[model samples]
Target chain A: MEKTGADGFDGFVTARWSALFHLARLLCGGDRHRAEDLLQEALVKLWFAWPKVADEAPEAYVRKIMGRAAARSARRRWWGERPVDRLPELAQTGDMSAAVAERSRLETALAQLTPRQRAAVVLRYYQDLSEKQVAAVLGVPVGTARSHASRGVARLRQILADVIDPVG
Target chain B: MDHFEQELARMMRDSQEYIPFASEQRERLREGVRARRRLRAATVAGGSVLLVAGLTAGLFLLPKGPAVDRPQGPLTRPGTSSSSSPAPSTSSPAVSPTQSHAPGTPTGTGTTGGSSPPSTFPSGSVDPTTFPPNPPATTATAPATSTVAQGTRTARPPVSSPPAGSHSSG
Candidate 1:
């Protein structure tokens, strides 16, 4: 029974890791390491709750955990800093393509918004969740969730105006 | 949704690059679960210990009924019941002076002075006329009479002594 549960959990995490990581990235406003940390933290909690939520929606559980953690971490900014023996790799401009440039611009714009705004925008637009669903996940009122998404979209539009044509 | 919103959603979807769940991450997750489990166990164990300790301390600190109910000091001892003994004087100040002066003088009212003679009647029967008109103090020294009188006087209230004055006058 234990082995089957473990296998089920592993298989689910392995299958959904990429999608969950992406959501975590967006929720964290494009901080790759922070997104990885957030995803890992949510997954650990999911391991404990797997028995209850496994037959239902484990992905939704993970998404809720990540969203709430991302929102809460805004007050505790120390998680962004870490003692590292080696410096991180900088973005290479040598092999830069339009897609990579666009991705970078998008991430840069996302990073400009607060954690809550970024999470709301990502959940509403990317995950295709309604404002009420976003509010439930973030533990906020629907009006607040809608406000966060609208304000986030407004900010993103201002930042990505030059790249994304307004005519389309 | 507007065109910009559509474009924004498209861009968000396109930005996702697939990342496989690696062994390193799996190991880290297992470690986190184990660490949390150990922390929970320790917290429960420590809390139980503290609760038991608090209850035990409360029990030990409680006052004992038997110890408190037992009378204190030699003054309360039965050996000091003799009329001549000064211990009863210190213990019961009200009865002591009457016992001491009862053998020498006929103190008036006999309320205080007559207290010692009533205990001498072991049969619980005493004729009021047996009390001398002028003095009940003469009978105060008789050991059998004085002991019985003192015992009775200590047990019964002084109001019972008024009958002695009534019969003494008759």
Candidate 2:
């Protein structure tokens, strides 16, 4: 029914702000600045689409917008081509706890993955979504999404081998 | 769940506190919506101006009708005098044969219906027998008076009383 004006939108934003913001952060691999930019862009898009949204759940529509924004930003950043080498192994040694070392390694490794791979990993493991759900979020086939997750996990394991599993 | 997946989920949960939606976040969203509206308006304005300019240019650039059809020379009104003569020549008994059949002259008497009279006289043989005794004074004074005055000058007035058959017509 013709939801006019920005009042309903403002209320929706206030109600779902935390969840959407967290989703944006996850999609952008915890880059707070990029995540905020992505969220703002998505909100602007939603503002334009607010009238035509009809009876669909606003959160799902906005979540889809956020995912698309993340993908487009990735394309723009990489010039539509994924980088050949996202993470180059660095040779360094330090004495730290396994948890801190693994966390730091994950953050650095996450930043190095292509946008789609990072998004797939975040949606699958971090957000606890099934492969099908992950594929829907990333707009890829289930097989492609599984490949992205496997490849992303393999890269992270390789990069953090010294910290996550020093013996093996 | 694999040990690596468990660790990843735990780390993501820990990082959840990093990005909270506060007043500043809402402000940024409001600003974003405003900027988006402004951009849409500017795009519409630009498109409208381009459309108007295109139509105006198209109107001016189209080819006009052929140039050959336009009327040339001065237009004559219905009641104005013609040939520079103040009055009509009703009293002259002897009409020059060439004047009656001049190629471009009009045959009617209306002010505007007739074509313009010939400005220059035709150079041809003159007939001495057709000279009228009382030629209109205004006719001789017309701008093309040279030919008429010359034609009259060559005619000897003494031949006015010549015998009807004695006049040799050229």
How well does each candidate reproduce the native contacts, as fnat?
A: 0.71, 0.48
Q: Which stretches of candidate 2 lie over 4 Å from their true place?
A: A1-5, A75-105, A128-133, A140-142, A162-168, B18-20, B62-170
lDDT of 2 by residue, B65-96 (tens): 44556669776645444564422332122334
Those runs of model 1 whose alpha carbons end farther than 4 Å from true positions after fitting are A79-94, B61-170
Docking class of 1: medium
Model 2, residue pairs in steric clash: none
lDDT of 2: 0.61
Candidate 2, position B55, lDDT: 96
**Which residue pairs in candidate 1 collide?**
B118-B149, B119-B148, B119-B149, B120-B148, B120-B149
User: What does candidate 2's lDDT look like per residue over A36-120, in tens digits?
Assistant: 7887887788877887773466776777677656755665743333344545453353776655455545666776676778777
Native A-B contacts reproduced, model 1:
0.71
